[model samples]
Target: MPQNIVVSQPEDLTVAWAQRVVKLHEPHTLVTQVDLVSVEVGTTTRIRLAVTYHAETALPRRWFVKLPSLAWRARFITALPQLLETEIRFYQELAKAVPIALPVCLAAQSRWGLGSILVLADIEEHGALPGEPHDVLSAAQAGLVVDGLARFHARFWHQHGTVPRYRWLAGRVRQVEDHLGTVLAVPLMQQGLRRSGAAVPVGLHQAALHYARNRRRAMRFLSALPQTLVHHDCHPGNLFWQQHQAGLLDWQLVRIGEGVSDVAYFLATALEPEQRRLCETGLLARYAQQLHSHGITDVDSGQLNGRYRAHLVYAFEAMVVTLAVGDMMPTASNLELIRRTATAVEDLDAFAALPI
Candidate 1:
């Protein structure tokens, strides 16, 4: 019943390439309607179900099934399967090493290779969420998120020094920085950014022209550092705080990189420094201490925190993104990031005066 849902088959169950996953994940549900909820529906294909369950008793929870974008929606060399695989691995790996309380992943499949399918416990709807956007998280809400990141990062303090794959993700940011000017000439990213709130700054408007060149410079710095498995995007939207437990979503972006990357990016872009400073050190120390508890005593909190401060590159990226994405549908925490990054780029002249 949703506006743009493509129902390619007359049989009712299978629709285009999405049938395999639909029948695979939930065979019983008589799916009556589906909605594509995310703002970036075009980049890849996704469907959200509103089903009529055949169960007798009231179900204890709700689950959502996600598969690779529809055939016409495929982009970027079919990385969707690998994307799901890495996500499953991240949760499996993180749970084993760190023991953080995360939503139980019910089932995941990479049968389609780069075109993956996943059926995960829908934590937000089950746990009770507003299902809307806002500007700030209360103090307790923020604590729930930072504590999880703190604990999540703590486990990898041992064995893995720095993850190669993670460093590659950070480098991709430069690609965004690089072909930006050329790509901005296109509309998808431009449309998304224009609506995200934080606008592109004037001086850095042209910096994206040299993205490939700057990427080498930026990643060379990240590559020389210590590393571990990190939940790189630990912002509020990806974190869910329920009554008894908290959960993290969208692990597709997980990577092994500097401890500083998550810390700085989270602090700089998710919370206002002034507000985050209150509990930032304490939360960070807690993360380090958690690492020590796991026997990775060699990890230094001061060094970790120091590098985190230096890795504010994303802060610059966030400022410019506001222009392309429009109002960013910011969460409360993201609002702080936008305000702080704007001041840093304008008042402190950080990105404006950078020696590129």
Candidate 2:
């Protein structure tokens, strides 16, 4: 086993560390410079590295690094231990098996109760860029994302029990349910609910309350559906686009759950209401067809639709909790996400779809 490298600060990214990262991709590559390009600190510390090599080599000129946030509040809110363990394990153990594109993990290390460091190939150089949070995706762009998600989910469909390696992907839903009450009771959650009243649809207001009140039931209903690996946070900001196809970023929330939950969340948060309405059914069909192509023949269309409807509420609940606990993005971006998701819930009659 390779020993884990300890890196807690930007200063720790020395030439030796750069060499290690480059060696994984090209053994003969020599790293000459590790220039810091940008630093973003939120739930995680995202740093962009501009590199200089001693000679022409296969190593990328730029890389992206993810490390534990230095902020005390962010550290507390993010549950750094679990988040780091999950992301590192995904890159190390599951990235190869996934069919869709993901950032190439050059180096990843995690330590319980401490922090983690992840170095990855900078997809930005490959024409991939993060989706703007406030900009809703066009119908064609949304279709590509759904297709990628379907391929990703189909790769692990119904294999959770058969594959011991996937056992780690379990338990996130239960963990969320276990902590839902505390999350709801927090002052931040209450404040967010009060501030968001004007944006939430009148019909779905009571539905949101139902989910908050009947947390266990809501979680159980979604969890009981067909299981597949899902990017639990598939919102626009965690996705990147290049050449009309979408690639996922931020694997911290990866889990084993109903794959339609990802679809519902993505459609609700990433599309304008008009675009979603025009393209949702078609996108769902596209997703199902992709699954079919991957030999997943048991998913009934009606059942999938029902689950998609129910999971819209799941997406709404998740956004509420997210907006409550932390400043997930800029205020305008976060509010837009809440508004769009609420609109989706009411439009789909998601409250009636899964009556508590």
Candidate 3:
């Protein structure tokens, strides 16, 4: 068996490491040179590399790698739950079976005391355009994403009776994250709201703060519905656009939850208010229809609509909390997401829908 190799910094992407990774997957291939192409630092450090082989082979020359955040604050926030570790597990265990478009995982590994590392065949090299947080999707583009998510959710719809691997997705790590979010929610919401200023309407402030105060209860209410594997964080920046389909990325937040929550998060963060108003009703109907097509016939339209409205609260809170956790994303993009999700909450009366 190959030894555990965890990469903690840019300097650690050595040719020897590349050779080891290649050997694990393709025994005959020998990696000759590993050139650093670019580095993007945020919630995680994304490094792109151009590789050379000793002999001609069909393997990809360009690779996209994910390591833990280089920033201390982002690292601190993510380390407690081992977010990157969750992502590595997803790529290792679930990526192959799920019928969604995603980058091919080349190698994924994590060590106990050290961090995790993921190497993927660069989707850009495969002719896909990555979406950005600030990029608003058109109604047509939003439909594609919705359809893709429907298929993904249907695959694991109410899959609680499944194998142990799928069940491992929501264990100790997620519980720690939940506890941390609950303990810190009120303060974070307050800070985020203050930072938001006119971006968040004054009328919604009390409702948002109230939800924050009672977040634990609200979370239970949201999770009361049918459970399925959810992308959890379905923001535009974590998606990529191929010719006609949208691919999911950043599986750090994947978990078991209501499927419509993914739909709500995506529409809230990916669409502008005006566009969302025009597209949302149709997109939701389409999502339901797709689920039905996948033989998930038990979903009721009325209940799905209600759950969608109720779930918008989390979408709003997610953006606000992202703003609170400074340096996780670009400021302008974070604020814009806040504005969009706040609009979604107000427009849907999401706070009123919450059981809290």
TM-score of each: 0.65, 0.91, 0.97
Compared with the true structure, the alpha-carbon lDDT of candidate 2 equals: 0.79
Q: Tell me the tens digit of each residue's lDDT in model 1 across 153-232.
A: 66554336354433443455334533443343334334423443553444543443343236545555654564566665
Question: Model 1, 46: alpha-carbon shift in Å?
Answer: 4.7
User: Tens digits of per-residue lDDT for model 3 on 318-340?
Assistant: 88988888878899999999999
Stretches off by above 4 angstroms in model 2 are 1-4, 23-28, 171-188
Worst 10 residues of 2 by lDDT: 180-189
lDDT of model 3 at position 312: 93
Clashing pairs in 2: none
| Reference-based lDDT, each prediction | 0.48, 0.79, 0.91
Q: What TM value does model 3 have?
A: 0.97
